[model samples]
Target: MQLIGLWALIAATLGPFQNVLGWSISGALVQGYDPISKTISDLAADDSPVKWIQSSFFLAGSVLTLIAAFSAKSLALPGRVALFLAGISGFGYTYFPTALVAPSPNWHVIFATIAFVLFSAWPLLSMRFDKRYHWSLRPLAAISATLVMGATTLWFLLTWLEPGQPIVGLSERVIAVMQVLWLSFVIWSQWLHQKKGAPETAPELAYGAKN
Candidate 1:
């Protein structure tokens, strides 16, 4: 149960985490959708001077979570690799000032999306496997993952859809709230189902691990 709380807490931290990092460095609130908007904006003002403090903050948090997911035994090799990539990408974006105001080489964004997708899916897959074959946490995992993935998807949609309009509009904020809250629940579920008695260790899918 305590472990459960730990997972939820970590998941919940992401929202305020980014907000503080962005505001501290940029001196302004960033788009909840982009999360990295403030960082990039600061760079644009100064030819994008690298914000090591803020960037490292984000990277460290992400890496810690990835480690927890691994420690929790919810992620496997593929998910770990993807997470590593995500961390690297995040670090690059935050640590290096890009000439473009927004992230360029659109493919970088795509890769990040893929990372998050895998991140969200692993838990869902683990829960399903547990519920169907092992009577584990499949249902809870699925529901939690669904909520997170849906929210993340909405984030992508809102931020990418209409650039002329604000990225952190009402719809996007709503999705961010949902993502944070539900992702917390998913983490809690992972903590709850971390063990299924004896040799039947938890699934790697929970932590975005791939076979």
Candidate 2:
């Protein structure tokens, strides 16, 4: 279990790292791609020259996230399910690559919105009041993570909805980074908790056993 947890941690960390790196590389490779003004989806749009590059990264990252979700046995079931759904949504949007001239509320947009909502809400969904759980899974920490991610998601949505929004890309990137960081943090906390030999559940005291 511990080894699997470690694997989960690695997957979680790599998912974010690869995504950010891929975004940077794809942006640089595609001439006229503007990281400050153009959304990452633009790099993977149907007409994008480097669509393959960005799409590949998005697929890989989503796969990694799914792997993490499956291997993270220490996480609450609700959270794990949310992560899995988010991963599925990621895969959905990647494969449905946004069309440069698509109509409003297309498949890509629908999947992306679902992914963002799940990613931002998973922490709160995973919260546990038991002392056996890691601090990151506690109510306070979970609530904080959700609030922060939710705020960023809202910021991105506002920018995305506005016509000719200059900061759409930046806001999207911010929310994406925040979601990844929080996921990685939760996974790492669980890994450390296991490493320290913490009990998964509080063991009941043996009848008449000494303190």
By TM-score, the best candidate is 2
Write out the backbone clash pairs for model 2: none
Q: Candidate 1 — which pairs collide?
A: 43-48, 74-207, 76-209, 79-208, 79-210, 122-205, 127-138
Candidate lDDT values, in order = 0.46, 0.84
Candidate 1, residues 138-178, lDDT tens digits: the string is: 56655665566656766655564456554433443344344
Off by over 4 Å in 1: 1-50, 75-85, 95-98, 101-104, 131-137, 140-144, 169-184, 189-211
What's model 2's lDDT at 98?
83
**Per-prediction TM-score:** 0.54, 0.90
Model 1, C-alpha of 76: deviation from truth (Å):
6.9
Error of 1 at 168 (Å): 3.0
State the lDDT of candidate 2 residue by residue for 1-211, as single tens digits. Answer: 3233767878977977897998999999987878989999999999999999999999987888898779987767898899899999999999888886776668898899999999999999877776656888889999999998988898898888787999999999999988987788788877777676565444633322556
Mark the regions of model 2 whose C-alpha exceeds 4 Å error after superposition: 1-4, 199-211
